[model samples]
Target chain A: MAGLLLSPTEKVFILHGVQDDYRSDGRSNIDYRPMELETDVVSHASGSARLRLANTDILVGVKTEIDVPKPDKPDCGKLEFFVDCSANATPEFEGRGGEQLANSISNMMQKAYHSSQAFNLKQLCIFEGKQCWKLYIDILILECGGNLCDAVSLAVKAALFNTRIPFVKAALMDGGNIDLQLSDDPYDSKLLDVGSAPLLVTLCKIGDKCVVDPSAEEENCSVISLIVGLTGDRKYYYPKDADKQQSVESKCTTIGMNGPGSVAPKTLKDAINQGIVAAKSLDEALGQALLKERQQNIGIKKHSYGFLK
Target chain B: MPGPDLLSSQGLRLDGRRPNELRRIRCKLGVFTQPDGSAYLEQGNTKVLAAVYGPHQASKSKSTTEGVVVNCQYSMATFSTGERKNRPRGDRKSQEMSLHLRQALTAAIKTELYPRSQIDIYVEVLQADGGAYCAGVNAASLALIDAGIPLRAYACACSASMAWRNGEPEPLLDVGHVEEAAGGVVLTVASLPNTGSIALLEMSHRLHMDYFKVVLSRAMQGCRDIEIILDKAVRDHLAEGWTKQDVVTI
Candidate 1:
């Protein structure tokens, strides 16, 4: 993350604004920036989507390929996430400048989607252990506004929803080799079940309240922030805190925060409560948007308005 | 080669196009509001977006007294090709493509006009079916024009492949992914069509020296054809108040 500089007076101005539940940018504490999303933008990829939230631009493409599953996880499939921070975003990302940030974001996404509850990999399996469909979720970071993790997660989820894996016809054994038959019909494909996919929500603690999506200027005012990944149901949060003692039979935890700043115990509770409420709305909005795009007839007749006209 | 089955007995190549015919090219300028200039181009199934950032103050180390430094970066989307690529830009192939992009654009840009300055042209290939380098160059030219940069002429690039048809050597124009994978000799030419001066020419497979003239001329003809299409697009783009919807109206 590039550190933004703000004067103490400026910080106080933002802090005062957050304390009242109103942000410097006219957004409420839990309100997000105005977002523009488009799907089926790239014709070459199996599925693609571009999302712009304020200054943050994220382009996600999902490519499908056939590969043998891991020995231990033979019955499951694979999903790999690769994030590229191109120099087009900023001069700072030139050369190997953005590698650290890119790696951290990819790692966080890997952690969030690591659990089976968050993503069912078994659905991608084509055979018992010999073959499976591997999905390569490539995320391109065009611009980094403030909440990159949240924007990326949203775009990835949308891209996954747009993906269509070609139908596999049959697997026949000839002597010692296996021959796979694939259906040529473009419409004969399977759509991934992404309802349970996790969406990341970044909460910046400004003053005593937490804000969902912070601008670059607002980010400078806060010392620490929390990145919480939640599904639509909000039934659980992955990577439970090891410090917190819990019973094995208990339900999943609902809060995840990361920050260097300390908050009052009451403020922490309030922030967690707000985070839950915000996550639910975000998921619902995302789900509806994806569903609408899916319902629409997406075909060659629909002119692809990529960055071009 | 897929043998005699690729080219039909009617002399039509795969996808039902004549040897000298090019894929449909559609382009738009000034697509993004943030960059100084930006353009998007689709060569058949291949889609590319290019953005121009500057001609502003050059970096301290890169500043030159005689001419402006032209910096280019070419990156393909991970899912652009049939198989997903692990990285977008840092790889050796992308680095080489960036160099080739600079070579073509530099020939067209009037670098000496803006000394001690730098121009950043970034090209992103959203979908690559083949001829990615040519598409990148063509898109960058449009973006440079949209940025209002001083240029000598439109930098046009096209590719040609040689095939034996009925005992006669036939040259294909604007080779697509299918033709490129046929393992025939491919000749790529980037030129200033009006000046008839070539900036860069590369050949992937070896062909007889006697056939070079025909193949090169065919690629040059492709460049001329592309220039016409691009010129029409620019004119139509300007006539439509430079809006995306208006450009795509046709």
Candidate 2:
């Protein structure tokens, strides 16, 4: 995390602002900062996305590899999360300084997606018990403003939505060996079922009140923050499809707590509820943005404005 | 001796680049606000981001009275390459690259003015098509400039490979991934083009002594060409950042 040094008076101002439901940047407790997102930016990976939430910049690239499924979960695929806190973000992240923070974020993502309801792994299965597609979600933190978990999870979901797995035909050969043939046409691929992927929301508890998407200054004034991961609604991902609009309620997948301070049980419960609301809105906006971009890119070459714009 | 078909019959190298031609270099400075200076650069398919912090107070152990201490860290993203990497940093290759970056940047920096201070340069390679080290150096130089740090001149790096065409050795400038994979001799040179001083030079594989000068000179030329592009970009950035102040004479 990037350290932000604020004076006692500044902290008091922010704390009072949170109590009044109006933050310094004119955003309410539930309002998030403006974000810029672009998907399929990295050509080398199967899918990639870059998201900038305020000053926190996150780039995620998802790579696919074929591997044998575990004996216990033979019908499912695997999703592995890796977070790399680049030294470019801050000097403290140089060498192995950022490893601990990176591990915590990756662990949160892993736990969030561990449930089948949050993400269906069966869609990635190629040969059921024999082979499966393993997705490696590599997240690169370019900058840390605040609320890193939320930005990372959002970028991961966007990248997974952009992932395209090539169509392959597998046949049982001699001695139970599987023969796989891949389609030559690049467009002949299947998109991942990422509509229900989980998104994490960090709710910073400030002066007995919780605020979503805390800025760096606000985070410095806070003592503890609660992270909640909630599954997204599939209806919002695909636009205007009445059949897909069979409203399925969002479910909680994972909960995490950070900072050295303790919180009351009642405050913790309230914060979790606030987090669920924030995640729901965030997921809906992200899905709409992704679908709109896809629509614009249809039947045309996408001119990627990576980092330039 | 020509081992692979790096050059076509029409004297064009792999990736359709003519001899002495450089790859497309697109760059922007001040991409991030967190760091004092940040830059993103793309050379052909290789993309790199660099951030510079300091001329600030150095730690007690690392402080020096003579000149500013230059610290460098070079790390690649795990998904930057074709094969997924387990660790992004703290590896032998990254450490070596960090040291090499320090050497190249130290030559251009005016370190004597900032005694008892330290400047940290961190370069991250987001895509490793080819010539990643060269792109890293170039991007770091831009970031240092963006920080308003004093430098002798722009330190640019470029790579060149050697190939034989029509019984004559032809030097290929700005080597791409395919040419590098062909196992030809690649010469990487970082230099201050205006000052005409080589900061760091590295060569991979074997090349005959007779053709070494040609390759080195070609790489130096490539550096000069890159310097022109970077200088123009800096000027444009400055012009855009500081609009002319309106003055009224009554």
Candidate 3:
């Protein structure tokens, strides 16, 4: 969404609309535009998901590897985030042109997934201090409409939810060596527990008001935006345990801001609260969609509609 | 001759395809609005996206008085292959692929028509199951057409491999990742099928001079077949009302 061209009159109109709590497209301040999500799209990766929010297209693939646990964090595995902005999105991103933007997004995502409350790294542990699973989450930006961080986070969460770790038996051999064996059965794997995976929500400040999921026009009008990453309730991901579900408050894992505009403390607090509400609703909807797809998969072969559809 | 068990006893190559058959090709043009032209193409398991920009004024250093400068880049997503890739581009293999793309596309483009100008073609591979270069070339060709750039002919690329059935040698068309890794001679060709001229030709591994003609011919035949599929796609795209803007060509 490189500098969209809009006359002064258009910007003012968008500003007035934001002040009135009604966007030009008739969306309220906290409403997000419709988005489509699909999982297990890439056959090569261990897990994959594609998210389309308006014109923004994000594809995330999760690949797993076996590695020795860190000397300090012997009980935890590793997680790495890499973001690639493809030239297909915009020619301006060609050949290292988009590196700066890519680095920022990946760094922010890394920070978001750092908190233990957001993602549990201990589940990836194989043999305590000996070995663990390292997950590589690669995000590819095919098209950019606006609000890239939100789309990428959602896509990555879905990809993680779709990821599977094969069952491995580790045996401690004589002296200090470890021998690992993987079962031959394809079903000998377990799905990753991603109930508390964080989702990012961007709040664009326009005309003294904050709005969620701003369009490119609104993005161009706003000088500042705040991105909040918050955790979702575990009950939604595991509906079978609804009777025993516990009520947990959503927690913020990371908060970031962009643009040169200054924010008042009061407005910043209010915007962060607004972002949390928006993220919870998004999480609920995503959980429902993913669960429904899982239900459908059990009855028959899941027909993958990749880019063709 | 085909090495290893690349060919089953029934004479069918790996992945259940005859030696002369190609993988299924599916393509769509104008997938993105930001670029001057864009296309998404999937040849069997391989998927690629291509975008085209310019015929705008060339950068000062790249401009030439005789013809337009053609620039190409080839990149793959880090998660596109079986093993995760650490970087997307700026590698030796990707650089060579970019050079090969520029060579094939430059031949079909009417570069002399736009003097002192430039055209940029960028290809991104979303999934790679072998023949990534050929898929990139095909996708870029469509992107060029979507941009409505004038061309001598559609520059199509395809790969062929040498396999043995019974006592005779067979040329496998549109080799997949399995057959490619089976250690056989793979001959890749990019050609202007309409003009019956080869734009670029590359081969890896060993092959007898006597069988070289057959392998080259098989790859060329594949290009011709791909040209037909691409032509039909362009026609369908036009019929679906992409002609709102006049495709004015010089």
Candidate 4:
């Protein structure tokens, strides 16, 4: 942020490029920067991933702990997101400089993942209203390229997919106290079903068009952008013999067009449509990549090239 | 020491390293295109990335007519260790590290060459196992070279821990987290290995004055070895002509 400065003419040039469906880096409007993702990079975390999206580098580690379920949501668990923007990215981000950006990103992610349709908290529950698993998703921003939301969400999704929760053996007492035992073998764990987890996609509205995954230059050119959080298929669960009836379309499975931006109704509509298409394709590609990585892990053919290696 | 069990009867320390062996160092220069200079270094499990910017106009109050202002900042990742840290910088420990880094780097940099300018060197520890300070120094040195900064020498840092073996004091080079946590006296030295002059030296815990010479010399030797490895890496990086920017400049 400190060293990356663009002249007025350069900003205009980038804006014009976005309007013409081309980016400064020769990428299309919806094209993402070349990215590399690796999972299980940190041995200490329950789940870990490192993602490099162009110059932006992000690492996410998910730790699991036991806690009592909330009385209102007795059957569900809890999730907390913390983002640490390290000074390594830039000297300007030293001290508490990046705190505002980090807070904003973390807040946006929390809102995106708030709805039950985005994640199934029931899977994290260990006992009904007694004990539950709480997930601490810690995100470390190593470097800031541009479009931090998109990159962080993608890394978080990949890390969540890579997370393994140890299976708990529990016994219930007459007083309703549950005793739990976790497996000693590290490999003996349960993988989360994060297929429906949402991934944030930022659409930077340049001259007259919107570009996905804008570079730093492109970001400096734009005035405002819309963040869209799109999820894959989500299955609704109900208790046995419940009187209520629900349908898939009734839940409104998508959340789009967020952030501080004002747009024409027509352009907003177009952006939403574009966002849905982009999210679907992105989700599919992410799924394929994650599945391939998981297969490689199973075959012992993958080596985690973390920062050290 | 636990009465000197750092080295076992089988002649192996924790993490399976000999008394004088250093951790494997893998490094890459010019990892990023944004910074004027960038380098990534990994010492065993600890990983550090350093980026250099400037020789440009100095910020207000920092400019001096005599020489360039060499500014440095050191930070660590929240999830870099077993326990998650709440904050990465602005802490007392990080401030001390920043000061230490500035002292060592200022000694190596030819500040008089660029008058009334500022150079910013930033080191970020992505993963911290042990010897993070040493890794930061080495990585920043590479970054300075990549940025074409004139330096007296390649500034190298290494830590030596003293433990009694066979009733004789032995200093372990490049101590890892396990060894460091064992609570032995650790002497960290940053120096110009060729000149054999110390840039910065810090000691934590206590050591007898009689044994200080041995421990300090051992740390200096480790720095010399690191310089050899880093020199080879720089040469290999340059030989490959992997720096595409050179083509544009040419």
Give a tens-digit lDDT track for model 3, residues B1-250: 4454777789877799888999999998887766788888999999998989888899899999999899999999999998889999999999999999999999999999999999999999999999999999999999999998999999999999988777678888999998888889999999999999999999999999999999999999999999999999899998888631244210
> In candidate 1, what are the lDDT values of residues A65-138, reduced to their tens digit?
88899999998999988898866676567677888888888888887787787788999998877889888888
TM-score of decoy 2? 0.97
**lDDT comparing candidate 4 with the true structure:** 0.82
Interface RMSD after interface superposition, each candidate: 5.1, 4.9, 4.3, 3.4
Off by over 4 Å in 4: A1-25, A169-181, A233-261, A299-301, A307-309, B244-250
TM-score per candidate, chains pooled: 0.86, 0.97, 0.96, 0.90
Worst 10 residues of 3 chain A by lDDT: A169-178
lDDT of 2 by residue, B1-250 (tens): 4544999989988788899899999999888877778889999999999999998999999999999999999999999998998888889999999999999999999999999999999999999999999999999999999898999999999999998887788899999998888888889999999988899999989988988899999999999999999999899889877311121110
Q: Candidate 4 falls in which docking quality class?
A: acceptable
Ranked candidates, highest lDDT first:
2, 3, 4, 1
TM-score, ranked from best to worst: 2, 3, 4, 1
Clashing pairs in 1: none
Give chain A TM for each model in order.
Answer: 0.88, 0.97, 0.97, 0.89
Better of 1 and 2 by lDDT: 2
User: Which candidate would rank higher by DockQ, 2 or 4?
Assistant: 2
Local accuracy of candidate 2 as per-residue lDDT tens digits, A159-216: 9999999899545566887877777676899999888899999999999999999988
Clash pairs of candidate 4?
Answer: none
DockQ of each: 0.37, 0.53, 0.52, 0.40
Task: Report the TM-score of candidate 3, chain A only.
Answer: 0.97
Question: How do all the candidates rank in terms of DockQ, highest first?
Answer: 2, 3, 4, 1
Better of 2 and 4 by TM-score: 2
Best by DockQ: 2
